[model samples]
Target: MLALTGYVDRLSAKPGGTIAFKISSTLGGEYLADLVRIRCGDPNPAGPGLKILPVDLPFGGRFRGRHQPVHLGSYGRIETPAALADVPVLTLSAVIWPTLPDGNAQAILTVGDPSGDAGIGLEIGPDGAALRLVTTGGTQTAAVGAPLTARAWYRIEATVDVAAGTARIVQTPLDPARLGLRAATTTVQVTGKPLLAGAGTMLAATPGGEGVPASRHYDGKLEAPTLVAGDLDTAGVPAGRVLAAWDLGRDIGGVRVVDIGPGGHHGVVVNLPTRGVTGARWTGREMCWRHAPKDYAAIHFHSDDLYDCGWETDFSFTVPDGMPSGLYGARLRSGEHEDIIPFYVRPTPGKTGAPVLFLASTFTYQAYANHRRGNLDEGFRARIKDWGANPNSPDDHSDYAHSTYNRHPDNSGVALSSRLRPMLTMRPGFLTFNDARGSGLRHFPADTHLLDWLEAKGIAYDILTDEDLDDEGVDLLRPYAAVLTGSHPEYHTPGTMDALETYTQEGGRLVYLGGNGFYWRIARNPDLPGVIEVRRAETGIRAWAAETGEYYHQLDGELGGLWRRNGRPPQRLAGVGFSSQGLFEGSHYRRLPAADDPAVAWIFEGVPETIIGDFGLSGGGAAGFELDRADVNLGTPPNTVVLASSEGHGPSFIPVFEDLLSHVNTLNGEPRDRLVRADMIYADLPSGGALFSVGSITFCGSLSHAGYDNPVSRILENVVRRFAAGS
Candidate 1:
């Protein structure tokens, strides 16, 4: 546990709404707590240093601290039914595809007492399948001598006859012809009496003794686990003797495991496993699980899946009746350690306080919460110490789990992300990279560049998050004259996309201040708050790719991947979509011929420099890293005008995969070099509404250059002022 760290239950709340804070501290004494308003967040000495300010509140005071633990892993738990408590004999069977066959002992199914010391379990070991029976006298085991192949389907069965004092275990490969595998079976004698089964049943994991968490988690897929009341043979048991049968394919969109047998012993899934996966009998016909649920009747369980910390609330705060809408945080301090848990306060419901609204990319932040890039070397550590930046990185900590951009221990892609744990990357002063030109910031801290500039310019604006906008429809944005985005609004839900598109088409000005906006499609469940799911399907600049038949999300049964593949490219809403990405470096943009048009020339009134944004805090230029461009074929409005385009990018940058049909050719027939550039565009809608897009993730980092008087800042100010006044 950290000396001081915590997280809020929600990202945003309106005035008169309450938010809870869950803290974890190892300090023996009391810790100081207070409220703060976050402004800059960046701590670079050359740029505007951290500008967090204190706010007086009644909830600020000293509080006692305690340590809280986070549990990680995924499994299924079913209460032991009356039929299973005192059976003469018991049989367990399941179809499994083990990803780590040679790994440590993994439990496929277990029927145990409350203490977990007295039970019968069917498990897979380094050699092969095994059955362990624990009684009052001693523990006994029976094993098959052969080894099981990894990533192969197999059927396992185990039987325990208490009165007969005998146990049996068997393993058979599903495809014996392909791997040259054979069936193996073993039967052993038992000497002690078995204990009553009143505790429960566990799948993919075993109970951790008394008053402990689950342990020995399985790393693979399991389907159609069933339990019988009598010692059954290979001939199969009668339907009336079936005690419980869990159909893993049922309720593919929820966490509950359905029981189709006569006994109603249903179970609930803990953490979150990969559902809608290919089962043992999957054919190559249907690609979607919704069309063929039987073929996708498997759940992939992992030992590192974490959905929540389940920590107790340390304190709670209710936004004052008239609190202003802005970014806020709970400052916690203990000894020499400190942490700030950030949250946003939105304007009161049914009230409009400002003409401009800043839409925070909370979904994107959660998607990259604890990303472990593995680039933190000695030089990065030295920079952190010298600059007094946040002293923690995901590379050094794995106890709280990682992001969807990372992979599991078995090398499978992480598909789900939860915001319940302390997100080290979202904290103030958190540096993502060690840059030679400027402070290396991304995501949360990087977005503050615009906030600091807005405060400095004395612009009155309200704040809202993607989650909030998703919960409330376009009505939440309909009252504002203009909506401005952050530096990297990449992850979004279909509802949020619909809201933005509707708002823009219905006479509302939209200023897209970032690149890679609305790139990937994400899913959310109302039953599971603060969690988001993504599937890196087919194509994109992704960290990992989803399996062939697992491209659909289990949260809402929606096909997951780039929005472009779903027929809703980012260009349709923002007039620009992702085009190129490269190392953390930048290049300058040149004014295009279309900028000279009298209708849009006013955007460059006071900016006389033809070559602007050459010097900035992020990679020393305004356009770098991920870039976007207007493509008419991909839904960019034909009436859109390109104001400027970036150039001079190093050879490290390349066009995205979606733009390439071959090594030497592009899908749109444009030169690869010309395709790897950002385009600044403007488009007018049918009403008085309009759009202004700057197609670079690093554009906001240039807003504070030359003390907030650079061309980038000037152009944005002109657009915001005009849009706010309804020009």
Candidate 2:
């Protein structure tokens, strides 16, 4: 299908600030463009679905698909000061566990340029491990007798005597079953080559060729690659002759490639390969990488590992003065293809008279970008197409890139996620969990229901994001009296958490409108901007578990995992923490006895129904997908009041792993069970600040029901109005 797709350079721009867009289209004609303020992104007719109003723009342009470079692959490269001309003899040795050996020629180690006749490399191919050397005379090759077995450890060595015009290859299987087999060896001779211009560039996973862009990427684990300068000795070359030696385990917490040789030839990893992984010699004695990093020395490189797409700008647009601070996009359409590059126009920095701020969950948006679940059925696909939703997903757009939820070609979980590429899921009408009950809204688009409600009720609010908070700290939230969270703000960094926590403690009101928020602790590396790293360590609803010692983050050296494991559960910040999760089915929340208390009676100002939000979109109720609860044991403030608790969750609902010591039958949504229900909480902070938490990710999804005149809407509106008017 012909379609228009594009990406914005940044997520949020201040009034008068510029944002760049890179548009790609298959249609050969001119495309129409305009600024649309997106209110609700859900295309379901059940709620305020797909509410976007166009803002007249004076810009028009033609766009066509152009070939763009997308670098994909993980490899290690180190520049050597010595040229290939100076080093006549070289030997390379490493331990490898090939995962996809027959797929392509994986260069284990290279000493020179492959394009010219002055390089030498050891590689694994369909025929087995081989050694190839290019000298001033000619190219010489050597290989083992048989192909290497997949997932089996083997010690491989290759030596090239450039002056002698001879090359030798050797392989010894480390696996117990193959220990009896004799070491395989092959040799070849060649006769005059020419000296290459540049110094030797050492590389692993692919050759250091100048002209070949796709130089056969490696997909396996490589550990401790060593290169020696002298000829192969009968007693093995002395340690002093080692030209380069790398210990892949030294800096497991960072991206520093340690060279333990005399040359000090350190290097760096690109495209963010999986680290702290199982390597050769791992005896299962220690699972934590920190305690036994030697066992985790291997780096798993893959041919399809991608972390960034450095695309040039098609055009830049500046938000004009007086443009309302809200959700906006560069709407592009050509022929039958359409795409909207969504971005937020934040208010100009200063004390704008607005009293409320919508903190868009940009971090969470980036974390789940381009996730490919591989469960899109024919019905779901047809529904998406009929509803005018952005249909391009990670499954269909491998050219853009995969998500952290996806795996590398070697089957290792992708730990790093970058926002540099086009995020197909962040667009309007992007369904993450095609619900059986209603539209499945998530991330950036799901959060727009609150924006639509705020606009409909004429609430004056400014929009900001987690990046803004992380960059500016609490200063960004200081001007607003109340700060509101988006649906499923499940990811956060220390800076963003600190800013919001400090803001709430310093008399700024907080309205946590979602569940499973401030849950996972992620890190943004300063060296790699727009990229976030998550290590799903101990005890949470996880897709992949981080290896033992890798629970700590490589970027910030902080503990990476759930905030609950960090001892600062969401309860400490918002008076409730994640307790249970299930399918995308929702049930209504019933008024707790505490809601009738004089302290929080105003929260239910116009709501007369004892059972609130029993019917709406988002699985048909106020609490669904994931739920949180107030717990004194997990740091829920003693003064916190539970205003309402959800009821009647289906059989799929179950307590989270952290809250369970055993799998008893009663842990499932029984009455009076603390872990089975979402608790709508209210608490006062140390200062004049206060927190009102809905404790459900789908709470906002019910706000658009009955034209925003329902009890859920009334209760939230009441809280927002009172909180905005306060200190």
Candidate 3:
């Protein structure tokens, strides 16, 4: 039994909101006070102190006064009987928590007491109740008759032992003189909540396990209750033994109970009565208890179903102030069920759980040469640039040949960044489960690929790929703490963006490891497969990065332009939009940062010039591949950060690499180029979309070349490790 406090006040007493403590009943929750107590709220908001609700077992209302008898009878049935129709039913609330069998497991139970108002049997599972009471327990049941009227104090107890697949019925009395016990029986059963000494309802019937159709009732005081072995035969018990021990007074909790009519005394059987029950009615103070536990330990979250839909369980054991740094899981069993939710624990209360993200990319790991002149790599690289994004990786499967191009784009980056992989995979090593990267491959869990390697390391991960998002849904990423993407993660679908955006804003971390990833702005028809509208300036689609003068209304759908109002780009909305470039400062480029920015040196782990330095790993301003930026259509908002910059590739001769930016369109009458080719994203500006680009192609080279003792590798390792740690 839990302690409770009650408190209430009018505006004159304690003005403002109130702080109420929770109180519940296991039998049948019908009253508020029976469950919780509370402390009133006031105007002076000094941030309150500790105050427990009053637990006056004998009292009714708030802690304002002493306990008083709670009784009300029709002073005279005038007109309305609305208030009188209220009563609690035992076995209607809390009772059990369940556990699933390692293998196949099934059980059966029997019933008694034809009145049906007695108890129920339940099947235990991890998340929800597997089974409810089976009305067909047995043919005979308990009896309520002259014996109960004659008895001064008596108690009846029925129990189900699942392990033995039996139900027992036992009768006891406060005085030894009144006692009768029945033999065990076998049949189907109904699960039940707790029973308290109070007025309860008759066994109501429904489809499967409803109370009998008899208008019978029970009245008495139950004391020292206990369940016995085997199903019992109530009719066999003698009537004198039942009436001899009538518990006329109250029980330990102080309440009354009695069976009405000739339903059953000590050895009688009455059919139960049932009807349509829309909702329950609450009277006064009442306690609620767990009748049965749940089935699943963890929920794979899905937006279609609200996350709050997750079950809320009462933690019987209070957590300690200082716990160790590790994962802790508990199985809470109310009766025979349980829910297992594991939490990351730290030594102190403020200690946090580390979030890991691994973003894979075909951009970095793919074999390609850096742009020597730092403009655009108009060579074989461009030809194969779409290789990974396109549908033409390998139509056929081969052992040595991996559909790398067709593989999941974000796998590598997300995995490495988070340092975690999937716990399960598909059969052929193609389909992936929790892994963020391999979702596109369809590699079976049993497949011997990168997925297996990850499992071997026991890395905490969920391998998911963009390909999965298309065939599947954004729901795949719901369980992750955060998601990461690799640099140059080009080519995206509107659906992909929807998933990424939802995950980030909904308290999920989204780390962009690769710039220009998911920036393709392709318009696809869910109905028509493979019919995508790419050009944003016309119709049937949109161009999220179109030029200013190139006004295109239907571009979003018909043609799908890159930059337009109807299909407006992100730069026009959120300031400081994402930007990219091939500019890298190395043996090339005139102006590299003066010794690179020292602020990022810490990120380099003491090596200041890790990304770009005297080693000349990264060349300056190679070629900005795909970058998002704030321009005319949508000048980025103020909050965006310009992490790095590059010179050249403009309208003026001041910078480097042939400055021929804006040029008049020979084909069209509108102005063609601008000073800086600011890239654009669709509706992604306000959220502070980011961009880190290199005017030099050597940036990728610098990063990839960072071998064993390479400074670049050291920098990346440090940064990635920290990222995984959620620092």
Candidate 4:
């Protein structure tokens, strides 16, 4: 439990722009707030240690603090129709594939007053499917005695007859031939009639009263939930007019749920449930949802889906007109506890302040925002205490929410990640792994190594985030001579990719400073700002795999997966693509014969060593962790030069799954061992543009080695200087 934590409304803002900060403090008192410019976040004692310079701002002072609650769950809500308030009889039916059938009671459908307790609904619990009726007189229920099997599709129907004073609930398996399953039906006399005034409909959760949070979230897939004006027959078929039928199949790209019935009781999905999924009627005849949206009609909801924390703003800071573009944090402190909410400040919109741009991997950061790796053992804790690093870990706190890299409680892959909550993993000095060789930093904190080096070398650079680039496109990169990426820029949207590719093709220099970059394709919807969706379809080194026929993103209707699978391999843009991955350990890169080419020899001008970057903060070497290599067949330019290649990785390292054809062979016919090496490559593009790629996530970690005087540092400096000069 954290004593104090907070998050910003947005990740980046232009000068003179306002950004709000929301704080959650359990400390029951005023907490100190200040602004600080973050330089280096790596907290290793042997490294530069966390370097943050305080900035004097008018908003820096003590403020009252309070605990802000985070509500997590995904559901759909439809505004109540007047016709439902006085229906003589009603029946609710839907096709369901329950993921946690034996868990607590979960609402499948409910239509009732604002207070959900007074509702006519259908639910599934540990026992089985049930029909629940609540009214001004009393409450009644009819339940199926047998338990529903997990992950099996079943049609559930519940009917209520007000004048007849009777209700029934039935559960029929979609595949009756499956073993250990059978149809169930239960009937009971109703004692009271429904009183549904000012009613609304809820799917996957029981609605809470006004100012109350929802509960009893269902974890499963629901298809074609319909509400009928009358009763359902013994065969589970509706016998009356369809009052409202929610076709989850329509609008497969947005949050709106379509209602095909005459009542026009359409609803919107909250917290982003999984859409473009295989419904009960799916026949495997079509895989893409666009081809046959009906087969992908189901929406999979989870009890832990959190889109926004909806925290109130404790304070907001409008960047003063002349504020320089850089990384800044809202530093909050309550006695012994502290948190720094980081945000980037970019130059004024359509303005340029420097020749170089540092593109912060904010999308990747959000994708991995609160990743709970479940590896925070005693040793990891000990190192945090020893180094005085950020004390909070995702494993210790799940209130904010988990990352896209994590799975839900029901074991489904978390496909969407939002930046609207406190991101513990993006904070300064936040350690990720318990590395034996170097500081265990990966994303935001790890990216600061290059920042510290740039400051040490007195280089003028402006900073912007991936989100900014995605929104602004090529125009954002057009003002800069060179652009630099952060470490492990693994997640990107099509807009960002197109922008970078266009920038590079039109004479822009791109210094790809990390590995496994331009890899995963993500989707961003303008309507849902601060959130990105990823579907790990087909192939890649992924944390979780999207189910079959669920490869498209529900937000933008784009196919989500590896960029290579989308026909735009990273090699086409940066001269290298993801090739191998290993535990956090590193090995040195040896200078290749191509290093002697006069065309690019200046890259090694100040470095005479044949073996480069053998010692550094990240895993003790430059080429380690996730690695990429140039492959002509995969779109590497013919003119690309392989300057160096890393070797001597330990047995823990292996080729990425995409490169594998079998246990002994790879798709490119390279030996498995040979495919696991990182290549440092460079290529000259048309129109005076160029690309310099250091194909390792830990490459930037070596930039600060030996007081920023090492070969890796020198090589990068040469390229940056040349690129900035338009050479």
lDDT per residue as tens, model 4, 287-327:
78888888988999999998888989999999988788999
- The number of the candidate with the highest lDDT is 4
- Candidate 2 lDDT, 627-650, residue by residue in tens: 999877677778999999998888
| Least accurate 10 contiguous residues by lDDT in model 2 | 665-674
Name the better of 2 and 4 by lDDT.
Answer: 4
Candidate 2's C-alpha runs over 4 A off are: 1-3, 26-33, 57-60, 63-65, 79-82, 112-118, 126-128, 133-142, 145-154, 172-185, 188-202, 207-212, 232-240, 246-267, 275-298, 665-674
**Model 1, span 121-190: residue lDDT tens:** 8888887888877777767766787788888998888877788888888888988999898788888887
lDDT of 1 at 298: 93
Any runs in candidate 3 off by more than 4 Å, and if so which?
A: 1-462, 471-474, 507-509, 513-518, 528-531, 536-559, 563-604, 610-637, 647-698, 708-715
Candidate 3 worst ten-residue window by lDDT? 413-422
Winner on lDDT (1 vs 3): 1
What lDDT tens digits, residue by residue, belong to model 3 across residues 228-311? 222223432332212111111111011122222132211111110000000011111221111110111100110011001111
**How many clashing pairs per prediction, in order?**
0, 7, 214, 0
lDDT of 2 at 662: 66
- lDDT of every predicted structure (CA atoms): 0.87, 0.79, 0.26, 0.89
Cα RMSD of predicted structure 3: 26.9
